[model samples]
Target: MDFLLLDDRTNLKLSIIRKLEQQYSFSERKDVLCEELNISQYLLERSVTEINEDLKQFELIDDMELVEQSSEIILFQDAQVSSSVVEEKYLKDSLEFTLLQTIFFNQFTSIKKYGEKHGMSRTVVYKIVDRIRKELAQYEIKLSKNFQLVGNEWKIRQYFNMLYYRIYKDSDELYNQSDILAVQELFSEIKLYCEEVNTLYLFKHYLLITLERVKRKQHYFLPNSFKSVEFDQKNKIYQTVAQWSERTLKGTNREIEVEIRGIINQLSVYRLEFCDLENDVVTEYTERLKQQFQMNMQLSEIGPEFCTSVKMTIYQHQFITPLIDLTLRAIDLEFFHERYPIIFEMCHTFIYQLKEDEFKFSKKSLFFNLLLVLSQQYDEETDKNTINIYVNFTQGEKYNRFIKNQIQIFDSFSIHFQPVIRPDTDLIVSDYLPQVTFSARNLIWLAPPRASDWRNFGNEIVRINRELQLNKKRK
Candidate 1:
């Protein structure tokens, strides 16, 4: 057994590898794997090599291998190792990572009990607890003396739900199969009343925890301020959940009722109206934003997809404020404020309009969602007539600052410029274009920027825009 210090990335890699191993044989393209893992090809290859080395130590040689790789595809094969062996090895080697699982899934009441069960000294357990506390602090959650998680209950549930997925992602027994199936059936019945994606897994985990707590005579009481579903709707869902639980868990009617009520309360916090953005209020708000920002976009140009995003943002803020708080906490505010200050400021102004109690949206949620929507909308406008431009510069920090300023200017005119080479590039705007062959249609070279360079560049951009429009008209 080995106790390795695992960063989040490494943990994710191991989980990915374990999942791949379970399939025994599968063919995935390199690009597809990279997209799934949110890593580059080079990083993915390195991770596979590292995972192979780890597998070797456990005498699982030839158990998993990348059988083939090419420009278009990557093939993986596993030698069909028994489930027991893999589960045993995973549990032994990843015990530290499993500590949170024990605390969460088992509802351990005290640090001493956890230490005794793990065969670790109290001091070692405390250190681990301290580390967990630091992690929880990122979400503004507190670990209490009774080994309880204290925070906005919604945030607590979200945190634990995510943690559960990460820890058991590779395991077939992540949740009881029957329980998951039950949740799926319940969701199908109630699908018309809510809009959700991949929520069954989380709901199953919630149900499992609720049942465990009930068995131990523990209860979660909803606050008086909690807004539940309408009585008739809640009762219908409660009856369905109760009937399923009675057959599945053999829970008493009273106990099942309590658990159903708790589940419904949590679900209410996440249920979103499918067509909320089609209303006049959201349309009026979108128009106000365009005028305030001096954007050239018309109401129709913003599209239904953008409107749907706005509705989700509103729902998140109004019903799932804690999730929005968690998202804001994860953002690098200072970096965005520095690089995209204009957009950031615009977000603030837009958020201010939604500050009324009726809207119930937090400033942070509005700012984050508004920034995302505005940036995408601006990019779409820019892409319509402008060419993609990849920047090449040598002066490091100074060049970086120059590029950021250039992006801001280009954005104002709805002119697209990549400033970096991405998969789909159209032109190069650089201090000096590199000699390497490129598929882009044009290149605009320049000396290092001077005070008048922006004016000259703006004029050139306007000329190009007119040329593109003329080409379109001719076609």
Candidate 2:
């Protein structure tokens, strides 16, 4: 995650761009802007020049002014390209980024030789490697004396997967095209359904690692946490991947099983639905927790779906390193844990029942996940969004905030303002049409919305929330 962050200079330029765009005046005096960014006018002007140069790349097609200094005021607009594209460009340009991908692919490159070919000093190369080595050490991985990643081979794969998955975003940047196709084909044949985010790239990263290691005659050493673990070899996906591994690796059956168990373990843990899994690990864990609730807590009101979700969640923490931090979203759970302490206690007590020898159960992961799932059940505010709305006007961020504030005066919990467009967005209020296609719905297009526009918006909200209530009642 540290590696994904841009250098301070690049970060400053982006911050400056965002700062100017956020101004309701839509322009900032050069001196004021420099003061706001805590930089000298000289550096500010040079950063602006750099920004202009990058914008010039699209100048042939982008006739509209995106970023400019009109006399004393620094004017900024959202570029035709997204912030992500800008970040990706900066990421690829980084020497540290290149070195990381180099190590991931080549595995054993001489840094001095690499620096020589790249016109960088040996000191600079090792400085970069030292930074990487420190980060890898946090994950219990070693950047070995041989310049290869060493440790639990599975963890090494996870470490790189996190790095590549964050940086690449499914681009052909670091993956083999054939491997993507084959993995996708296997997924289709198995009819796997996993709702965990970024699963496509997960398959890509692991498959690439598997192919690379297998081709090099490097058999994976199974982690102690997975020792003596049982898997449903009869599961269609498991059998399919196993057969593929056997045919491709041409290794002893034991080695092939090791690969299959490792891969399948990951695939199963992230699955949104495991009713199809022959072993149904979640169901087993769910049943155990349910018995505990019945005998100790005298509580069986927890839904089957909720029980399964909680169990699968703790199960995953045992094997998977968290791909992202989502603490803020689950903050409400802390209140619940304090108020209904027994629910939290029941969850806490159930964790001790887990296998001491095989599973690496994370108490914190379980706590966070319980918070996330339980929030929907107990936090009444979570259901307040009956008609989610995203306000984006040509007038930009400051104007959007003003409009959102005005809408809040309505005192309607049913009409929640979403920071971003979501699948359930009932309306989008903007002055100009968006550049992308969207499902046709209530779209208010008004530069200076009149009294009539407000009336129409209110009508639309009432209609949307009524339908929502009706649907809920029917359910």
Candidate 3:
């Protein structure tokens, strides 16, 4: 049987070939195979006989003849995998490149297509893509944008890539592998890093625009700034924004803007550690403004309310709820009169799900009102410890035993909890959480948005009503 032989370094050479194919032509670069073989100066002196027989597994020698007597001669002899066509030959076992091609070409084909091409079962092709993902994780080889990792169609990227590549080929703008990488960098970092609600809105807006253009068979062009963002900066911004958003969504009662500020200061000084700007600088500025807004939680500091309205309607717990409502209203009316939207949202969330009326009016009103009323006094920095201890305690017969206890804890300082009334509504106020102190200066924490708290509270009423129905059924 006439057989082909490869050297011990064949695996490495194959990898180099794959990388080169990703960069340039897979066919014309066939002569450049010597570069990918990477035989060192020391290996030049070693005779083929002296080399270990285990190297035969790589098929380095064919019929015991030196394939190329001179390294300069790029000869093509019979090998296990032929080097005939770019699609069939070069990409023989390269499931990674195959998946990438699908994404680049936007060609959606069934697993059966891959199975038939590779002489494998449909299940085998699925497994190959899965293994490729696991193997290329170090290289960050994402098959497509918007790929969801879990669920039955875990290979969702495969389908999406095929579609995108097909679309790309038809489009006027030519996007090669390098351009794809650049676009990926832009979306993951620059778009994701702009953490401002408004900036995020813009990112979504642009993404929708890009996606829409692609859908309409239009060529897409991202701004030059988007394509130039460095890999490391992109990584940092993505990590920072991801962490910030996770914490904010949790409503963890940490200082929101202060934490974000630290992210900015780190980015500002990142030049000392690494020299690269690209899109990171632009994203840094956006994050900086978001951090600034977060630092100033005062209602008056936000812009003119203009067309916004601060509407407060009582639905439950009429007694104690008034204390919290009236105090927030006082701040809105006297200081942050312009930021009616925020105030209105705050009030809306505060009473989002209270019952219209509870038969036991006193008990109904007091506990329901207490929850919202207590939360109003807490700031962006209120600790979990404080909430657990001072907000829910039911020690004396007093209605707000929790607040009363908290007042003692702060020595009547809780009275100062009345929302800060700004003397100058037009004047925007800013403050900095100073570093170089004994505190954990680098940590900027955000209390997660308790939007769900109100929503869940409303849901709880329905749940209680349902339980009563079930109880009556059993009786």
Candidate 4:
């Protein structure tokens, strides 16, 4: 996934940026980064010089320099840019990227002609295409001799969805202006028929991909095993999609039906489905996942909604797997994640137990998305340690209430804002210098708090929670 979006040089650049990000105080000796990356100090110095230039060129520096340097030390300024933003910039500038975009949108298929258009030799164009071919082949997709993307139409569309997403992002750039307008109307029409079009930006992109693929006479193909699962032809969502297909897409009746089913399958699995509610395979696997997640600390509560969401995720994954897929994903093991370690490990164990040899990205998606949903439904261990806070300001009760309103996180079970000060108060937050002077050990604030004050307030909460844990252990 990383390789697809960034070249080695950009990856190396990002690695440096990430390392610098880990240390909030940005100054690191050039020798330190050089040793960490196992490169020469001179090389590291040169890279730093280039990095400053690259950051400016990326146009995402956002009026703040992301990297700075002295002779011996590289200094970093937090540009507050996300990894995705940086990645899109790098991806857009790649030679292969431009070539592929031209092929997809501009029909620049002839290698020699492409070189002439782009001022590169045919050999260089061939090499770039070869690399793309190899990468796509890894996902069971083929860049054909005529440069057509050949594969299962569903998977191919998914691949193009990612490519277009990474490059254009939320921009209106998938097709020409007229076609973009047409697709927007098509999306609006579908939105009228279905309320699940929650994100217009993403659905617009998806509709464009579908239109482009259908224009190329590419339609959906399902695996034989899945073909056995029966669909309700009269299902409202299915009927709506079929009707839309008739009006919008160019295909035979069967092809349009298959494509419509494929589109429904691409939608959220929680919706009214064509085949999954009673499927034994989906139900059995859902139960198996629940059983596999048995752990020391249970979710404080598990409602019907949580169970249904888990079931539907499994159902969706069951039908969505291909020999390989090209969804843009980067999944990290969440065993040590602070907030949801229990849920993370439980999800990991359940996913590991599944005997099927699935693709890395698919397993990653299941684990990542399931953990996200589980964390939302469950409370953290930290939430159980209550921190009773007394808010006192030189200002009156109304002003104190305003402060509380500013910082209050309603969902946190760990922190409670007490109405009055008590001896049992775990912490004190006050704007009066005299009030917090004696109890500086707990926490303090100013009338107009700075960002660092809020940060310190959070740190105090963590410290109080840790103290409670230690006291429980002593008992």
Task: Indicate the worst ten consecutive residues by lDDT in candidate 2.
Answer: 323-332
Q: Superposing all C-alpha atoms, what RMSD in Å does each candidate have to the true structure?
A: 13.5, 11.6, 28.4, 5.4
For residues 386-474, write the lDDT of model 4, one tens digit per residue.
66788878788888889888867633535678776665677778865333333434556777888778878766665665565435421
- The total of clashing pairs for model 1 equals 0
Residue pairs of candidate 2 with colliding backbone atoms: none
Q: Can you write out model 1's per-residue Cα lDDT over 249-318, one digit (the tens) per residue?
A: 5456665565556666455434442224444555666666656556422223444345456555554445
Cα deviation of 100 in candidate 3 (Å)? 2.8
lDDT of 4: 0.64
Q: How far is candidate 2 from the true structure (C-alpha RMSD, Å)?
A: 11.6
TM-score of each model, paired residue for residue: 0.47, 0.60, 0.20, 0.76
Better of 1 and 3 by lDDT: 1
- Per residue, candidate 3 scores C-alpha lDDT tens digits across 111-227 of 677578768887766675665555434223344333323321211222232223322322324344443443344445544444332222222222233332233233322223222
Q: Judge candidate 1 against the unseen true structure and give its global Cα lDDT, from 0 to 1.
A: 0.55
Q: In what order do the candidates fall by TM-score, top score first? A: 4, 2, 1, 3
Please report, in order, the local distance difference test score of every candidate based on alpha carbons.
0.55, 0.61, 0.32, 0.64
